[model samples]
Target: METVMGNGNGQATSGGRAANAPHSDLVLPYGDQRNDGVVQVSFTLPVAAGPLAEEAARQTMKLMGLEDPQVAEATAIGEEFTFFVGYGKLTRAVELSKLRVAAPMWEELDQAAVNQLVQDTLGRPMVVVGAATGSDAHTVGLDAILNYKGFAGNRGLEAYSAFKVVNMGSQVPNEELVAKARELGADAILVSQVVTERNVHLANLTNLVELLEAEGLRDQVVLVVGGPRITHALAIELGYDAGFGPSTRPQDVASYLAQEVSRRMLN
Candidate 1:
């Protein structure tokens, strides 16, 4: 496969990679491994579904650099709105070899290992206080990690033998979370923020960190945040010890907490 250079605008330049490369260097859109450059996209338009609306959708896709744009499906949404699914050929090929992402540093552990680590290292039950704080009322992420039922078939922190989990549910205040953690002598603090409207989660998360710092408890506990938009890098940037993203299993959190608590205690 030939190597390709992107212009920083996602457009490939004339270049070549190693001819005997083990993996693909440049890749185009593939439908059923046909490599037809076929692309499917869906969007909504203000106009109602009709002949003009279909043309507008096609033209919009064309304007975005798609070739042979076709409005495969169109539906009228309420009165003045129309939704469309379009298919076209993408002209550019992406260089997968050039991609990079922030990688996680924590090693995951199983249920037994996590429990044993806390018991052997800490010599006591690790207290954890978790909540979905601020005006964000979403508790799905918090419940999944703290609740006994867990998420994705993994047992939660409450089910672990070594961690005492305190779930504060939804709409908890930052100050209250800090107070509760202090009151419980928590070894870890987990915050879940699902509502990112206008970057409200950022402010809410930052406020919690600031509150902990003000209370002189910021370095006393393992702090973690989780949400669909949350990333490890973002969590560290917001002064969190770690961040768990969507589809995180309970063992993932339990392992991190056990290791982090032990590390902090030893340090």
Candidate 2:
């Protein structure tokens, strides 16, 4: 006898239960029933909200592989922009067990532990210089990691006695960031890019790498990037040590730096 359980979809599926254990194989976007393939998407178009705009939204959804697309809501923003919410069937399944991602191998330690490790191993404060570089003038992400008052009430790197943090603020150029990092003899460089329009972040980040390599400083420091769209794999591909996404706390970055510094310099 197999016991049934309610998955994200409202269906009570045994799902090939073995010893009362649910199988983790193929998965679909659940709406109200198992394998229903329901999904909701939101987007903005540069057209005013009206009957034509509603039709456009539905047609766009269809082009995106959605079937039986229904425009749930359409609203006009100011005068020229239209925001749309649409629902449809995705009809796609992915093997959850087959998917792979780059996972962090280091352990995250608290402020005291990190400080002690740095002091005992390096005998000096680890210097980190961070900024929001390029035309991306957003500083919220950079500030959250470097400012003493961190995001979500977590203490920033400044709280760690073994770290010397220098937050260069927003709109810093790649040249200046690299120069400052070189000047400070920084052990790590953190860059936050919020604007990803036309994949500009890629260009900016790559340019920084090229500059660092030209200056012969690429291998000497840990380079990390963070933003809403960044991922660990993407960062590694773009010549960075690591990447962080939204809601990343200061402690998270600090802990990674501590372990990474020890790994790079101590060992």
- lDDT agreement with native, every candidate: 0.83, 0.84
Point to the candidate with the largest lDDT: 2
RMSD, every candidate, angstroms? 6.7, 8.2
Candidate 1, residues 8-114, lDDT tens digits: the string is 43223444443454477877778656457898999999997799999999999999889999988999999888999999998788775566434344467888899
Give the lowest summed-lDDT range of ten residues in model 1: 1-10
What value does the lDDT take at residue 144 in candidate 1? Answer: 86
For candidate 1, give the lDDT. 0.83
Those runs of model 1 whose alpha carbons end farther than 4 Å from true positions after fitting are 1-22, 265-267
Which sections of candidate 2 miss by over 4 Å? Answer: 1-22, 33-35, 44-57, 74-83
Q: What is residue 173's positional error in candidate 2, in angstroms? A: 2.9
lDDT of 2 at 37: 85
